[model samples]
Every structure is written in structure tokens, then in C-alpha cells.
Target: MTTTVRVLESSEEDVRRGPEIIIHENKYEFCRYNLKISRFINANLGFSAHVWDAGVALCRYFEKEKINFTGKKVIELGSGTGIVGILAALLGGYVTMTDKPKVLKQIETNVSINIPSVCRHRVNIRPLMWGENHTNFNPAYDFILGSDIVYSSVVYPALIETLRYLADQGATIYLSSELRKSNGSPDFHNNLLPHYFNCQVVDRIEGKDVVVYKMTKIATTSEEDPLPSKE
Candidate 1:
């Protein structure tokens, strides 16, 4: 689906001090989140940024699918406002939310305010630069989450490298993106085919112009062939 990229205007109230509450409703429950959004001007230009339409769509998709996150080890890359990771934690996943160092504070704040005290220990906020040496990050994560992270073409290689390095054997990956043509073609999705055995659009919210994909890593194959070689 082709979509025009339009930046939603943030009100003055949304730009003021503390975080703002955005409500995401699902068939089962409503998720109320507090996010510390960047200033309107800064956000429009993609500096740090705010909770976006695609992010909201991602949350709704999680609710609709009723994914079982209990005790799952999950990692979220480029967690702008920590919405997706926080939701995963709320659903019983042990989530690690990562972004650049500059955005870590906002992610921490969002997690602290939205996650219940009992579940707070399940969520970890950290800084991670895509493609950089991830010695500190474990490669055995059961699932990886990313929302609206395909908007930049320059980051494609880095993003793919990060995914390959972090994905465990048979790990699951969930990614959401706004279907905007201006952000470049769906090259990011195409790039994953070789690294991941199965990749497909699992859900799309047309009204919100968002698409979510479910991907799984390719299983290792034995180098030795079973067939006898012709002598």
C-alpha cells in the first residue's frame, strides 16, 4: 500500500513539561501510556521524536493477536518512546528496550511510569547503536521488536546487521512500519529474506497506514550431504 508521509501536528500541551497520555484500545483492554515527546518542531524533523501512528498501530496489533509474552526474552530496537517494549513487559515478557544514549532517559521514564511496580524489574532500558559492537547484548533473545524504524535508507545495513547479530536460532522478529513510499521502497523487508527463512506481513491497519511483519530465523543446515557422491 502506498501512503503519503504526513507529520501529525503536536499541540502545545503535548510539548510542555511531563509526559502525555495516549490511549490504545483493544478488544480485551485499554492501554494508557505516558510518553515524553520531543518538541513539535524537533519531532517533525525526526529528532529524538514522539509516539507515532505506526507505534500506536503496533500496540493495537499486539492486542488483537493476543501474543503470549509471559517469560519471553524480548528486545526492542530504536524504542523511541518505549511504548512497544513497555507493553511487552506488561504482558509478562522480560523486555530490554534500546535506543541511542540521547533517548535513553525518555525510555526509562516511560517504562517507570507505565509499568507496574511488580513488573518494573522485568524491563531494562539501555542505549544501543545499530551495527555497533553489541558485546553487552545477548544474542539469545527469543523475540525482537521494532516499530517505524524503516524510514531511513542510510540505516538499512546497520539495522540488518543488528538483527542478524542479535537473533537467536529460530528467533521471532516483529516489525511495524508506516507504508509511506517517500521513505524509500520496502528494501529493508527485502533485505531480510536471505537472513530469515520466513517473512510475511502478518497484519496491516489500513486506517492507520501501518503494516506489521512476522519473521523467523533460518535454521542451520548441515554442510555434509546425505546423497552419495558420483565417483
Candidate 2:
């Protein structure tokens, strides 16, 4: 006999940081597991501490597509709230959830709470600053994921460099972003990423104003060649 799981209503769990900051949990049910994602409510804990629409959309996209994450090596960049990476782990992928050093605690907490002890070893949290020294992380990952990380043009170069270093010809990259015309996300997806990777739209979530792109490294891409400026 099999059991069916439905999307559950969200409940809150609050954690206090010092005298002022309050972190609250946003609950989600996916893959027959309940994910409790914590976020700072009144405190400005940077964007990495909060859950974004792109991340949610990507999680849904994975479930809808029935991605076979079993036994795969996965790494998620800008893993705010650790939602997407947690889902990957639940789906049987060895997942590394990464973000800025300062924001790692919340993600760690989320991972610890949601991932069962049996699946706990499959998930790891690490600090990854885009375009920085990423040598500590393995270059070969079966799948690389990012959500709402392409918001600004200023970070494009470093982000691209990091992507190039972490992804090889055999790896697949999935990036989801809310395509806001005012920001450079639209241009980055349309004009910039295509220059380096073979990119395709895997999902267009119109309701959330989000688009998920599937990208793979171009075989001829050279590390020394500069990416075209996004001016």
C-alpha cells in the first residue's frame, strides 16, 4: 500500500537571535516530507536568509518533471532557506547547500530539522561566495542548481566564473530567476548565459514570474576566454 501526500498549510516557528532579531519558519510539504524553512522576520539578514519565489518554482519544477536525483551529486548555489537542496536530498541526491558564510546557520538549521537522520548524511552545508576561491568544492557535480541568484549584472562575471569552474561538459545546471525587466536577469538569461552554455528554458512559471533554465557547459569553452560584458 502507498500513501499520497498533499500540500500542507504553513505554520510558524520562531527563533530569537540576541535581543532583537526574530527568525520564523515557513513550512512546506514536498516529496512526502515536511520542510520547515526559517527566515529573519524583522531583521535585515540579507536576501540569502529569506525564501524566494525562484527557489519555490524550481522545487516544483523538479517534482513535476520527476527528475531522477537518485544517487546523483548535486550542489545548490545561493541556497536560501535550503528548500531546493533539501528536496534534492529527499529525492536521493547527495546535495551540498551553499551560501555566504554569515547566512549558513539558518540553512543548516533548516537542513537539520527537515532532513531525516537516514538522509542527513546525504546533505552538507558549505560557504560559497561566487567568483571566490571555490577550490574547496569538487569541480565535478552531476547537477548544479541556483535560484534567484542572477538578480544583478554586477555579479554576473563572478557568477559565471564560478559556474564555469564548478560545471564541466558532463554536468547539468538549473537556474531559476524571476524575470524582472527592471533588473538585468532578463538580459543575463537571454543574451549572456547563452554565450557560454547551451541554454534552454525547462520551465516558465508565469504565475510566479519565474523561469527555470537548463544549461550545460559548451565543450569548446575555454577557462581563459573572457565572458562578453553585459553592457
Candidate 3:
């Protein structure tokens, strides 16, 4: 599929046009944890992506010094706007930032925008399409990060399969998503988790707007490797 393109900056007759601005009365902050917004984190450059608010919130959850994140290998799937993966790099872990190859250029742009030069090396951006095989996949990671990815029923299985492929022996997966009705069917969490994964609710508190799930993979009886066997 051909991906849509949005220029970072546009100018006409020396007049500057910026990315469309989206304002939320209940706007949540993820660009920075403190009162100040760092230019590196929030480009103020533009808001072309989806609810980056969720990404900001997820990044805040990691940035707050509340969790012990050290020496872990992390990967963020469907990394739109690449916010969560960037935060993982900032938090002192090796993080792989993934999306389709076509979208990686801007994701790389976003990472370089926020993180220091030394830290930028720690972030690896790779191409990954759901359910399809990629040549350069590393078999293990300590965590899988995803947000708002469980919308389509067809893609849900593929997304879960992709995560299952990268999950390490004991690595945990974290996902944040809002409940939405779909085609007269149950939501992703309600309909999918029970069959493929052993899921536990990490947070479902009132007014938080999204549910965070601590997902652990369920082993299959098929005993088959999804990827080609190691040489």
C-alpha cells in the first residue's frame, strides 16, 4: 500500500505554514514530565499523527521514575510518531522502533529531534508489517510496547502474532488502548485475549480513558516456528 505523506514544513511566498494544531481542553502532557516542555520532545513542529496524547501519557508512565527500567531490550510496535520507543531510549534501555519501511524516515526524524546524539544510537528503527516475515528480526526482547493498535479484527491476530514472535522467554508486553465498538462485535480485549494470550489487567481505573494490559504470551501446542529456523 502506498503510504500518505505529510511534509514537515511548507512555505509559500515566504509565508510559513505549520502542521495543523489540535487542542484538547483535557490535553494531556507527554512532551515533558515537568512544567516545562523540552523542544527535543515536543517539536511544536507539528501534530500530524494520531492522538499523540496517548503516546505522551505512555511516555509519562515510563518517565516518572516510578518503574525500574534498566538494561532491558524493548520494542514498540506500530510506533506511530515514534514517541514511546523514543522514551524507551531515554529511560536507559536498548529499544527497537518499528513500523512499515515507508514510514521510518519520519520516525527517524522524530527520534533525532528529541534524543541526544549518544542516545540516538541506542534507538534502532526497523521495518515491520503485521503478520508478514521480515529478514532482520531479532528473536528476543524484554518488552513489547504498543498503543491503540487493536482496532481491526483482521489485524488484531496479526499484531498479536507479531508480538508473540518477538517475545522473549519471560518478557512482558505493555499495551494501552481505548474500548471501541466494532461491527457489532466485541472489543479486541474482550474477544481476542482469552484465546491467544494469558492477559492481566494492569489498569482499568475510571476516567483514565484507556486500559493498560500486562500481557504474557501463551504457549501453543503446534510446536512450530513461525520464522525460518536458525542456520
Candidate 4:
């Protein structure tokens, strides 16, 4: 099968035209913990400005599992609109949301709008590029998260390296990705990731074709061969 592209709009707008805003109000369990997320979409911002199914699925999985994030040190990678990190903050985690330098503003806007004043201190937004020096971020995070980040084969090596660098001995990693071949290949989860980390499927959103995986670094021996190139 082949992928198809549709022109959903009449014509692409100029990058300088600014973003088109869309508000998403998400609530869980008896109207508690309402999160008003603002998604900025336009030609300039690319897919980083929009919410993907993987993000939504991860948010739902968090709610369903009722994971204890209270007082936990957490960081989210590729936090497009900061949805997962915001939700983590709402659940009492000290969360850092990160993405490319360009999209930090959008994540910051969403973080400010959703996180309550008293809890705002728990959330921090930062710029991160995979495979780059991340010395600014501590390696003691209790949890590392990503949604739809495994969207390209080109990023696998860097992504894995970053994960290995950030994760401490006991840190847990959660990643969610859509199963669509057009969006990304499954080989990252099925083949490459397992070599670096012990991976297991923790949640599957029915009908969404999205799966959430839990991972921890595999213990390495000095005699073990180096990881194969993901290029």
C-alpha cells in the first residue's frame, strides 16, 4: 500500500499569517481535572503544533492506569502541545516538557493555560534536540515520556542515545506511537529499541491502533558488543 496526501484546505497560508488556534477541553472522571489545551496549527509550525492520536492515547492511558506521579521527577520529550506533561503535573508530578527550540512557545502557552497557579511551579518547559548535549537536564528523572516521537527511522539512533543518557538505573520510560505505516514504521519498537532497553507493551487503546510501551535500560556487560547502527 501507498500513502496519499490530501489538500485539506483550499490553499496553504503564508508562514507569516500566524497560527490558526484550536482549543481542546479534556476532562476525566466527574468533570475533575479539566485541561484546556490550545493547539496552534499553520504552515509554519508543521506537525509539531498539532495533537496526534498517540498523544491522546497516552493521556487516556495515564488516566486509566492512575499511575502515581506524586512528587516524582518526570520529563516529557517531543511534547508537541505539552498535553502529556500537563496531565502529569495535574497528577502531582514534577514535570519538564521539551521539544525543538522552535515549538517551545506553543508548549509554554498550553502549560500556562492548563496548570493551576499553585501547581505551576511543578512544570517546566525547555528546548531539547536529540543526540545533542543535554547537560542542562538532570539524569535522575523517575520517568521519561514521549508520544509520537518515533516518527522517522532517521531519529532512532539519536532517540535511543538520548534515552540511554537520561535514564538512570531505575528510571522508567513510557513511549506511545501510532501504528500507521505512513506515520512511522514498527521496526523501532519491534526490533531496535529492545536491544538497548527491556520493552513491554503496557497499554493498547482499542480502535486507535496506538500502543504504549514501558521500558527500562538493559544491563550491559563490558564484554558485550556495541549496539548496531540504526542508520
lDDT of each: 0.68, 0.80, 0.60, 0.76
Which residue ranges in model 2 land beyond 4 Å of their true spot? 1-20, 221-225, 229-231
Q: Please provide TM-scores, in order, for all candidate models, with all chains considered together.
A: 0.76, 0.88, 0.72, 0.84
lDDT of 3: 0.60
* 177 Cα displacement, candidate 4 (Å): 0.7
Residues 53-106 of candidate 4 have per-residue lDDT tens digits of 777777777767778799999999999888788888888899989999888888
Sorted by TM-score (best first), the order is 2, 4, 1, 3
Candidate 2 vs candidate 4: which has greater TM-score?
2
Best by TM-score: 2
- Candidate no. 1 TM-score: 0.76
Q: Which ten residues in a row have the lowest lDDT in candidate 1?
A: 21-30
Using lDDT as the yardstick, the better of models 3 and 4 is 4
Q: How accurate locally is residue 63 in candidate 3, as Cα lDDT from 0 to 100?
A: 46
Candidate 3 residue lDDT tens string, 13-81: 122234633322112233342121112223342332444434545555554435544588888887867
For model 2 the local lDDT of residue 44 reads 54
Kindly indicate the candidate among 1 and 4 with the higher TM-score. Answer: 4
